[model samples]
Target: MSKVVLITGGSSGIGKSIGEFLTQKGFIVYGTSRNPENYPDSQFSLLPLDVKDVKTIEKTVSTIIEKEGKIDVVINNAGAGITGPIEETPEAEIKANFETNFYGPINVIKTVLPQMRIQNSGLIINITSIAGYMGLPYRAIYSASKGALELVTEAFRMELKGFNINMTNVAPGDFATNIAAGRYHVPLNEVSPYLKPYGNTLDLMNAHVDSGSDPNMMAKAIFKIMNTKNPKVHYKVGAFMQKFSIVLKRILPDTVYEKLLMNHYKL
Candidate 1:
């Protein structure tokens, strides 16, 4: 039987491209979207799912299990981006960020773990971000959310080792995706100190993505991760600068890393 793969946020961008690429590679790929119709033409199956809603998550996974009988791999790729200064961001927005980027993936993981455990063999690939390691300036909440998931991924990997279930984090750098168009931004008026810099930095970041690496590279990286006998805890997928920055963040002092970030993002 072909390996059954489930990916979140498969309607467009990285998620969608990965699903398509995997299907071409002969995997039975199923993808998720809040609006299934929006991705009706995708090569892979598009299922409706809202990561924040337990019922929707369970139903989607159940539907896949019923049809495929087994889920060999799951890519927790469903997430959104939010941008703003820490102070200006509302409590609700921060919670929403965690809801989509953090808790959302957890919901799916919990739902699938039971089955993966029963099978005694499976892979859980988390599409994390470079920001998860080094928090970005304006995208504070987004970084925090991904960082939290990275911790969970680490702990879960240790706990699930005995079950033959593999867990890994695939941190993709800025890829040329439609995420920039859909990213959420906090409303900053004249009173906000961050209003001016926010616009300039966000635009620059968007352009960086526009000129960033190909989403196909991300898909290829994930393909390698999926087939590895025992994948490592974390893998960085992106350009030289992004990968180097992640490496530098690990070895560099906090002050030095912060300075690098400030200069790179023009903060």
Candidate 2:
């Protein structure tokens, strides 16, 4: 039987690309959207699900299990992005970003694991961000949230080893996607002390997404991981430099890495 797959936040961006690619590859793919009605043209099944909401996640999982009998793979791709000076960002917004990016994915995994455990075979892929590897100016919240997920996945993988329920984190660098448009940006305050540098960094961040690699690159990377007998605990897909940045963090001293980020952002 073809493997059944479920992707959260699958209506567009990287999730949509993954869903479409898997569909073409002959997997029984189901993509979740808070508003599934918006994507009538979607190539695969688009079901209603909001990662931040447990009920919707449970319902979507049950629906998939009832229809497919087994969920062979799950991609926890539903996430929100927030950018702002750590001090200026509202507490509620920070928590909200974590809700979608961190807590949300955990909820989805918890809801589906029982079913996956029953099958005695499954794959759980968490879509993280290259930004998660380190804190970035004006994007610390997003980085922290994704980073939290990455660490948890490491622990989760070991816990699931005995059951054969594999889990991995795939961190992608900026990709040409609608994430920028959806990201919550604390308005550039005319009088705020960070107006100049934050504004510049914000513009730079958006530009990177616009010029980033095709989403299909992420799609293909994910497909390859899904096919692997033992996917690594962590994988990254992006421009060489972006992936290298992670390595730089490991080999470079803390102050040096900080300087590199400061220079890149022109802070």
Candidate 3:
């Protein structure tokens, strides 16, 4: 039988590539995006959805279930980025970021879990980031939201272990995606004095994003994970440096790693 897969934020970037790739591989793929018109109709069915809205999530899942009868996989890839020091970021901005990046996936999972549990088999892939593991200088709020998401991913993995459900977290490094271009920013003028020193780091972050790994590579990694008989809990995808960074952080002392990161950013 063909596997049925649903992907959120699947109009473009990594999500779109994954949906296209999976569709070509013979999976019955459905992709959701806020702007459903942006998705190509020939490749995969497009559903209108805003991950931040619970009603939208519930309706989308209901429609998919009604059409397909069974959902084999759900990829929570709809998320946004906020770039600014935490102090400079307004509470409203922080809440909005969390609503999209953190709560959005949580809501989707909650809506889908009941059906998955009854079926006793399902795969969930969360497209998180390396920021989930470590904090960066400028994107404090973004990092926090991802960190929270990672924790949720871990918890779900353990909780769902006995239910015959699988959860995988893809922690990708900086990728050449529209995320950088679409990132929300707040003016530093209104922030507390404590956040002033991080301005230079934010500039460097923006520059680094322009030269990050290709989104296609990340999509390929996700494809491989989805096809696995038994996928691991976490997979990191990026350049050699990113792989090395994760390794170095694991082995190096806190002070040593901090120094390396600071030097790398010229801080």
Better of 2 and 3 by lDDT: 2
**Ten-residue region with minimum lDDT total, candidate 1:** 186-195
Model 1 backbone overlap count: 0
After superposing all C-alphas onto the true structure, candidate 1 shows an RMSD in angstroms of 1.1
The lDDT per prediction is: 0.90, 0.95, 0.85
lDDT of 2 by residue, 11-42 (tens): 99999999999999999999999999999999
Residue 118's lDDT within candidate 2 is 90
Error of 3 at 77 (Å): 0.5
lDDT, residue 20, model 3:
84
Better of 1 and 3 by lDDT: 1
List where candidate 1 sits over 4 angstroms from the true fold.
none
lDDT at residue 259 of model 1 (Cα atoms): 93
What are the per-residue Cα lDDT tens digits for candidate 3 across 140-180? 78889988988888888999989899998898888777777
Q: Could you estimate the TM-score for every candidate?
A: 0.97, 0.99, 0.92
Candidate with better TM-score, 2 vs 3: 2
TM-score of 1: 0.97
Residues 82-127, candidate 1: write the lDDT tens digits: 9888888889989988999999999999999999988999999998
Give the residue spans of candidate 2 off by over 4 A: none
Count of backbone clashes, every candidate in sequence: 0, 0, 0
